[model samples]
Target: MKTDDAVSALGALANEHRLAVFRLLVQAGPEGRAAGVIAEKLDLPASSLSFHLAHLTRAGLILQRRESRSLIYSADFVAMNDLVGFLTENCCGGASCAPAAQAASKKRRAS
Candidate 1:
Protein backbone atom coordinates (compact mmCIF):
# COMPACT_ATOMS: atom_id res chain seq x y z
CA MET A 1 0.00 0.00 0.00
CA LYS A 2 1.09 3.56 -0.57
CA THR A 3 1.57 5.88 2.37
CA ASP A 4 -1.60 7.77 1.43
CA ASP A 5 -3.59 4.54 1.35
CA ALA A 6 -2.16 3.48 4.66
CA VAL A 7 -3.21 6.78 6.19
CA SER A 8 -6.74 6.33 4.86
CA ALA A 9 -7.01 2.76 6.18
CA LEU A 10 -5.67 3.76 9.56
CA GLY A 11 -8.04 6.68 9.72
CA ALA A 12 -11.00 4.42 9.05
CA LEU A 13 -9.92 2.02 11.78
CA ALA A 14 -9.21 4.78 14.25
CA ASN A 15 -12.84 4.87 15.26
CA GLU A 16 -14.19 2.75 18.12
CA HIS A 17 -17.19 1.32 16.27
CA ARG A 18 -15.40 1.03 12.96
CA LEU A 19 -12.55 -0.91 14.58
CA ALA A 20 -14.98 -3.28 16.27
CA VAL A 21 -16.90 -3.75 13.04
CA PHE A 22 -13.74 -4.49 11.08
CA ARG A 23 -12.47 -6.95 13.68
CA LEU A 24 -15.85 -8.70 13.67
CA LEU A 25 -15.72 -9.08 9.90
CA VAL A 26 -12.17 -10.42 10.07
CA GLN A 27 -13.32 -13.03 12.58
CA ALA A 28 -16.31 -13.75 10.36
CA GLY A 29 -13.81 -14.78 7.72
CA PRO A 30 -14.05 -14.05 3.99
CA GLU A 31 -17.74 -14.88 4.00
CA GLY A 32 -18.33 -11.81 6.24
CA ARG A 33 -21.57 -10.68 7.85
CA ALA A 34 -24.68 -8.70 7.01
CA ALA A 35 -25.21 -5.06 7.97
CA GLY A 36 -27.89 -5.87 10.54
CA VAL A 37 -25.73 -8.53 12.11
CA ILE A 38 -22.81 -6.13 12.34
CA ALA A 39 -25.00 -3.56 14.01
CA GLU A 40 -26.31 -6.11 16.46
CA LYS A 41 -22.87 -7.49 17.23
CA LEU A 42 -21.44 -4.05 17.78
CA ASP A 43 -24.52 -2.59 19.46
CA LEU A 44 -24.52 0.34 17.07
CA PRO A 45 -27.43 2.21 15.59
CA ALA A 46 -28.26 1.54 11.97
CA SER A 47 -27.46 5.10 10.96
CA SER A 48 -24.11 5.00 12.74
CA LEU A 49 -23.28 1.64 11.23
CA SER A 50 -24.08 2.87 7.75
CA PHE A 51 -21.81 5.84 8.18
CA HIS A 52 -18.94 3.79 9.49
CA LEU A 53 -19.35 1.12 6.82
CA ALA A 54 -19.24 3.80 4.12
CA HIS A 55 -16.09 5.23 5.64
CA LEU A 56 -14.38 1.85 5.74
CA THR A 57 -15.55 1.05 2.23
CA ARG A 58 -14.22 4.29 0.83
CA ALA A 59 -10.94 3.68 2.61
CA GLY A 60 -10.67 0.34 0.74
CA LEU A 61 -10.43 -1.57 3.98
CA ILE A 62 -13.71 -3.39 3.44
CA LEU A 63 -15.74 -4.90 0.62
CA GLN A 64 -19.45 -4.85 0.18
CA ARG A 65 -21.70 -7.05 -1.93
CA ARG A 66 -25.36 -7.54 -2.41
CA GLU A 67 -26.26 -10.98 -1.14
CA SER A 68 -29.88 -11.12 -2.29
CA ARG A 69 -31.79 -9.04 0.23
CA SER A 70 -28.83 -8.48 2.48
CA LEU A 71 -25.69 -6.42 2.00
CA ILE A 72 -22.67 -8.48 3.04
CA TYR A 73 -19.59 -6.70 4.27
CA SER A 74 -16.18 -8.30 4.52
CA ALA A 75 -12.72 -7.08 5.35
CA ASP A 76 -10.45 -6.59 2.36
CA PHE A 77 -7.71 -8.89 3.64
CA VAL A 78 -5.31 -8.12 0.81
CA ALA A 79 -5.70 -4.42 1.37
CA MET A 80 -5.37 -5.11 5.08
CA ASN A 81 -2.11 -7.01 4.56
CA ASP A 82 -0.84 -4.25 2.31
CA LEU A 83 -1.54 -1.72 5.03
CA VAL A 84 0.31 -3.90 7.53
CA GLY A 85 3.16 -4.27 5.08
CA PHE A 86 3.33 -0.51 4.56
CA LEU A 87 3.54 0.00 8.31
CA THR A 88 6.08 -2.72 9.07
CA GLU A 89 8.00 -2.82 5.80
CA ASN A 90 10.74 -0.86 7.56
CA CYS A 91 10.67 -2.93 10.68
CA CYS A 92 14.11 -3.07 12.41
CA GLY A 93 15.38 -1.26 9.29
CA GLY A 94 16.25 -4.70 7.94
CA ALA A 95 15.96 -5.96 4.40
CA SER A 96 13.13 -8.24 5.48
CA CYS A 97 11.07 -8.38 8.62
CA ALA A 98 8.72 -11.16 7.48
CA PRO A 99 6.00 -9.64 9.55
CA ALA A 100 2.90 -11.47 10.76
CA ALA A 101 0.86 -9.79 8.03
CA GLN A 102 2.87 -11.49 5.33
CA ALA A 103 2.43 -14.85 7.03
CA ALA A 104 -1.25 -14.30 7.53
CA SER A 105 -1.67 -13.16 3.95
CA LYS A 106 0.04 -16.29 2.71
CA LYS A 107 -2.07 -18.48 4.96
CA ARG A 108 -5.24 -16.76 3.82
CA ARG A 109 -4.30 -17.24 0.20
CA ALA A 110 -3.55 -20.90 0.79
CA SER A 111 -7.06 -21.44 2.04
Candidate 2:
Protein backbone atom coordinates (compact mmCIF):
# COMPACT_ATOMS: atom_id res chain seq x y z
CA MET A 1 0.00 0.00 0.00
CA LYS A 2 1.12 3.57 -0.60
CA THR A 3 2.03 5.90 2.26
CA ASP A 4 -1.15 7.89 1.78
CA ASP A 5 -3.33 4.77 1.87
CA ALA A 6 -1.69 3.61 5.06
CA VAL A 7 -2.00 7.06 6.54
CA SER A 8 -5.69 7.19 5.69
CA ALA A 9 -6.28 3.75 7.16
CA LEU A 10 -4.49 4.76 10.34
CA GLY A 11 -6.44 7.99 10.47
CA ALA A 12 -9.72 6.12 10.20
CA LEU A 13 -8.75 3.78 13.03
CA ALA A 14 -7.51 6.67 15.17
CA ASN A 15 -11.03 7.16 16.51
CA GLU A 16 -12.27 5.09 19.41
CA HIS A 17 -15.59 4.22 17.82
CA ARG A 18 -14.06 3.31 14.47
CA LEU A 19 -11.38 1.19 16.11
CA ALA A 20 -13.96 -0.63 18.17
CA VAL A 21 -16.10 -1.19 15.12
CA PHE A 22 -13.18 -2.54 13.11
CA ARG A 23 -12.10 -4.89 15.89
CA LEU A 24 -15.62 -6.20 16.17
CA LEU A 25 -15.70 -6.96 12.45
CA VAL A 26 -12.35 -8.72 12.74
CA GLN A 27 -13.76 -10.89 15.48
CA ALA A 28 -16.83 -11.54 13.40
CA GLY A 29 -14.64 -13.25 10.77
CA PRO A 30 -15.26 -13.48 7.02
CA GLU A 31 -18.95 -14.17 7.42
CA GLY A 32 -19.22 -10.62 8.79
CA ARG A 33 -22.07 -9.01 10.67
CA ALA A 34 -25.04 -7.00 9.59
CA ALA A 35 -25.28 -3.28 10.16
CA GLY A 36 -28.06 -3.73 12.68
CA VAL A 37 -26.10 -6.35 14.52
CA ILE A 38 -23.10 -4.02 14.75
CA ALA A 39 -25.19 -1.19 16.08
CA GLU A 40 -26.81 -3.38 18.65
CA LYS A 41 -23.58 -4.98 19.77
CA LEU A 42 -21.78 -1.65 20.10
CA ASP A 43 -24.77 0.08 21.67
CA LEU A 44 -24.37 2.76 19.05
CA PRO A 45 -27.21 4.49 17.33
CA ALA A 46 -27.84 3.41 13.76
CA SER A 47 -26.80 6.75 12.33
CA SER A 48 -23.50 6.79 14.22
CA LEU A 49 -22.65 3.25 13.21
CA SER A 50 -23.42 4.07 9.60
CA PHE A 51 -20.92 6.93 9.66
CA HIS A 52 -18.22 4.79 11.24
CA LEU A 53 -18.86 1.96 8.76
CA ALA A 54 -18.54 4.38 5.88
CA HIS A 55 -15.21 5.61 7.17
CA LEU A 56 -13.94 2.05 7.57
CA THR A 57 -15.07 1.08 4.07
CA ARG A 58 -13.43 4.16 2.58
CA ALA A 59 -10.21 3.37 4.43
CA GLY A 60 -10.19 -0.17 2.97
CA LEU A 61 -10.19 -1.56 6.48
CA ILE A 62 -13.51 -3.34 6.01
CA LEU A 63 -15.80 -4.70 3.31
CA GLN A 64 -19.51 -4.27 2.98
CA ARG A 65 -21.92 -6.54 1.15
CA ARG A 66 -25.58 -6.33 0.63
CA GLU A 67 -27.32 -9.43 1.87
CA SER A 68 -31.03 -9.14 1.33
CA ARG A 69 -32.08 -6.02 3.19
CA SER A 70 -29.07 -6.03 5.50
CA LEU A 71 -25.64 -4.59 4.94
CA ILE A 72 -22.94 -6.95 6.17
CA TYR A 73 -19.51 -5.76 7.20
CA SER A 74 -16.29 -7.73 7.47
CA ALA A 75 -12.64 -7.02 8.13
CA ASP A 76 -10.43 -6.90 5.05
CA PHE A 77 -7.64 -9.17 6.19
CA VAL A 78 -5.39 -8.27 3.24
CA ALA A 79 -5.70 -4.60 3.97
CA MET A 80 -5.12 -5.23 7.65
CA ASN A 81 -1.99 -7.21 6.85
CA ASP A 82 -0.80 -4.44 4.59
CA LEU A 83 -1.31 -1.87 7.32
CA VAL A 84 0.64 -4.01 9.78
CA GLY A 85 3.37 -4.57 7.25
CA PHE A 86 3.62 -0.87 6.50
CA LEU A 87 3.77 -0.04 10.19
CA THR A 88 6.48 -2.61 10.95
CA GLU A 89 8.38 -2.48 7.66
CA ASN A 90 11.54 -1.36 9.42
CA CYS A 91 10.98 -1.89 13.06
CA CYS A 92 14.14 -1.63 15.24
CA GLY A 93 16.30 -1.77 12.09
CA GLY A 94 14.57 -5.07 11.23
CA ALA A 95 16.53 -7.10 13.78
CA SER A 96 15.64 -5.98 17.28
CA CYS A 97 12.04 -5.76 16.31
CA ALA A 98 9.28 -6.77 18.71
CA PRO A 99 7.86 -9.11 16.05
CA ALA A 100 10.94 -11.32 16.38
CA ALA A 101 10.51 -11.49 20.13
CA GLN A 102 6.80 -12.01 19.70
CA ALA A 103 7.36 -14.91 17.32
CA ALA A 104 9.81 -16.53 19.73
CA SER A 105 7.36 -16.08 22.58
CA LYS A 106 4.58 -17.73 20.59
CA LYS A 107 6.83 -20.69 19.74
CA ARG A 108 7.85 -21.08 23.35
CA ARG A 109 4.29 -20.80 24.56
CA ALA A 110 3.13 -23.47 22.13
CA SER A 111 5.83 -25.95 22.99
C-alpha lDDT values of all predictions: 0.93, 0.94
Each model's TM-score?
Answer: 0.84, 0.86
- The candidate that achieves the highest TM-score relative to the unseen native structure: 2
Tens-digit lDDT string for candidate 1 (1-111):
777888999999999889999999999999999999999988999999999999999999999999899999999999999998898777867766467669889999999
lDDT of 2 by residue, 1-46 (tens): 8999999999999999999999999999999999999999999999
Off by over 4 Å in 2: 98-111
Candidate 1 lDDT score relative to the true structure = 0.93
Task: Give the Å error, residue 72, model 1.
Answer: 0.3
